[model samples]
Target: MYKKETRGMDIHTFATDGNQEGVLAELEKGIFVDSRNEKGYTPLACAAKSPHASVDLLRLLIDAGANIHAKVGESQRQPLALAACSGSLEKVQVLLDAGADINAESPSGYTALLHIMFRLHDNEMLLPMAEFLVQHGAVMDCESQYRESPLSAAYLRRRWDVVRFLLDAGADPSPLRWSKLLEAVALGSCHDVKELLRVPGALQQRDRFSRTPWLLAAFVGHLDKARLIHAAGIDVNEIGQCGETALMTSASIGNPEMIKWLIGVKVDLELADEFGQTALTQAVQFGHADCVEILLAAGADPSITNEYGDKPITLTTSEEVVRVLVEAGEDIGDVSTEMRRILIGLEGSSTLRVSKSEYQEGCQRRFGSSNPETMDVPFWQEMIRTGIPAYESKSQFGDLYEMTCVWCFNRFGASFTALPDGRYVQIGGEHEDYYDPDFCIYNDVVVFQGDGNFTIYGYPQEVFPPTDFHSATLVGSDIYIIGGLGYHGSRRFGTTPVYRLNCHTWHMEPVTSTGACPGWIYKHKATLSEAGNITIRGGTIAIAQDGVEDHVENNEVFQLDLTCMTWTRFAAEP
Candidate 1:
């Protein structure tokens, strides 16, 4: 064992000392040239990394059975990687010539060429060593564990020449190429855009959100890039997946400067999105007072109702917005009195107080009991039959009380359904992974009512869609949910189901069953503006991947316009 250790150290010392003669002579003395020291370093690795060692020493070590492929560190520390990171061009060549794996990776997944490009910042030999690694089959665009490419790293390091070299070798920078024009505009990096556009097929680039280069540029107020894109002849008013023109997008986010720029260029101001909301209405909905003022100055009509018959003024309660609309010849009389009262609470009014939740009630509620459709489990059905008390000890809201389980009403979108027989019912709501012992994690379609305080009827039906922040609006004794965010049948989305509950009879059923609602959303403002219009305004579109919440950017304003009690989705707000 002592002989083996001594042989390893002797060869390592000779290799690192640039003693080519000693390295050869040690082999003649039967010292194992490739033996590793305590640091796991072979003699060839030490020689390759030694700044004082000549190429001849490295060659002698390789010729004397030194391991070219032997790695030293827990990570990559192979002979070629060591030579490459040191920018030792001659040693790198020698190791490659002796059949080292050019693409050999460290334990952390860095390739040899990657080590060279990553470490030698501010060194004049960076480009040359980089070129050498690529010539010897080192992947120029090799990715690390974080999926960072060589081009991305070089760009981040401001190594312009290295970035250009990597591009020249066909290193496709998917991250940059994906958003070259947009990012250039956003960062005001006009000087680098030319090289970015030089990337093969750059002109045809679109972002992951499918926004064209010019749209992003204009949205960020970059007129120079906008002009460049406009010169390319793409439509400035072209609509995106969100159904927004650059003008509307700028208007939506309240970029008055961008809006003015777009207006100066004579883009269409009257172009409404698929939702029938003009740029003026979008600005109003988002409370962009500046955008609204600007659009109104640009001759945007305030009285122009969206598809929902709601004027721009109806989307906002802002005094500034109201002033703008009134100045633009809009009448305040167009808003319903109920809406006005709701906006400003009914303080000391003569209107008789309805049920605490606003559902109409009466003495004799409708028909016989519904034999609930078979869906819920028998155990839950038995529990429902027993009922939970509305007032475990005492009632909080009114004299009337109902014996009902909290399970039916403890959901996200669930609300009090007013019954004609002086009672109320709860249909559905939403919940996630909650650990409460008393309440079930999810709500069922079991019936409950405030009829003495409201009795909890056990699970009567298995609801198809779930309720997560679904909106509820009451018109007389009929309670309606506009749309909800959850699974429909099996697929989850921002689904619009015309769910109607007769507080009179306590019977709930699908009314329209055909209105193709927008994507799922929750916490949006939905209101029955008048007789038949249910306006659903700005909300987060509910999107989930593997049951984890996904980002929602849809500020969609849609409405369900009812005709003879049936509903149709309208691209309007009223």
Candidate 2:
């Protein structure tokens, strides 16, 4: 029980602690039953989440006018969802009996059924509670805002029993929006895969990214499922939307077994994809020595070059792969110095370091266009590392000393916004101080997908200049980039710079604004309100006065009403 001397203890604490007597005392004292705590959980939400909560205690709170219909916290979870998530059937029954909406959705569109299967624990009541909810009219195929259904959630949790139950309960194995067969294959569920394959036309379906079940099976090293898919009549050498064959996919992922099987089945070894890379080149570039040897033994060519003029030996840094290729009559003199350095870095845990000239030249040449043919670089969209060193002054015995500090791009003040489709966008960032020779502010956008693939996008100077220390707020389908410490002579007084990048088309356009401006600001924060206003606060603005830069701390808060593209200043009240 909470002591009376412990003053300021409210009904929320009592509800959280499951103190029935303390809650009654607070109720008698006339405390608001629906008042929220710091984390936005009300008294009922607090009680619903408490493991020690009783049905009678919850009934008392509801009797005291606690709202069963209320959704609380950042997730906006209902009391029924909270009760269901806590694995308490009695609490769930209490909330449902008190008129809680069983199918009510959270902000993310998670129903009570979805919330129970979200984060799986070893609680024995979870499956029973799921069954109870399903019997009580919970939608079994209900999807969240991210299009993740309960069946997919069950597959993600690897609850085969729950999966079997959902499948037996007649959950749709083939949803039009996404493929359940491919998901089952990716998750390595043979039973679910077989069940999903029974759906008509499931074998011939392609996902939104144009990936087939055969390609996914190869990518995930699921040879068993690959054989099942092959038996289901997806030809072993069929090309995907990007002209990607299963042999190239196997080689790229370093699956020697899959490569051997594809070789045994007579897949075309020299067939180039849209990138003009054969199975041998993919194996060598990814440093798969075993796969390389297998491909070479199976009469794969090493002397052939991709569209970027990079041969199998030229793209690889592995001495083993190089030795295998050299023994197969490829000249050792063909390997470039850059590839040799990468080999040296791969010998240990040390990072692969490229000189500033090489790094800049690579970015300029490769990031010139989004088109793979136009880029003409070997490591386009591949794993890359470029470290830039910055010298920092340190105090030693009241004297300043310089030390080198290495920082990577996007490790600084870069903006990362997650897209709706399980991918994210990384915008421009700088390497070091503006005065340093290594200092470079990037004017690029890189979108990374869930499947470990990324695309680098470049823009002209006027469209989107080099940016860093800016806020990229996702408002609807557009990401608004506002305020940054750009290059010298870039920012001007009396104007707030704002640019909107469409998430779909990747097009960037500058936004013209009206009203009072927080001029030339960086290192600030911007947040979107529910009413379509972007509130920016707490940044430094620089003023150039007679060749000296004066930095002023911006204390005033500003709001941009996105509806009108107008700014308003709010002064601090004393």
Per-residue lDDT of 260 in model 1: 86
lDDT of 2 at 208: 45
The lDDT values for all models are 0.62, 0.73
Can you write out model 2's per-residue Cα lDDT over 1-574, one digit (the tens) per residue?
Answer: 1112333347778888899999898878867777777677778999998987788999998888889988788788888899898888899899888888899998798998888887443456767888889888898888898988787676545465676677778787654235788778765488888888889988777754466888777766788888888878778778875788889988987899999988887788999988889999989988999999999999998888899877788788786887788678664435653443343241221233444344333433223343211232322222233221232211111212323222234235567665667566777777767666446677777675734445667777767877887888889999999988887777675567899988888888899999987887887878777798888887888777786667788898889989889989888611
TM-score of 1: 0.34
Clashes of 1: 18
The weakest ten consecutive residues by lDDT in model 1 span: 359-368
Model 2: weakest 10-residue lDDT segment is 391-400
Best candidate according to lDDT: 2
Top model by TM-score, which number?
2
lDDT of 2: 0.73
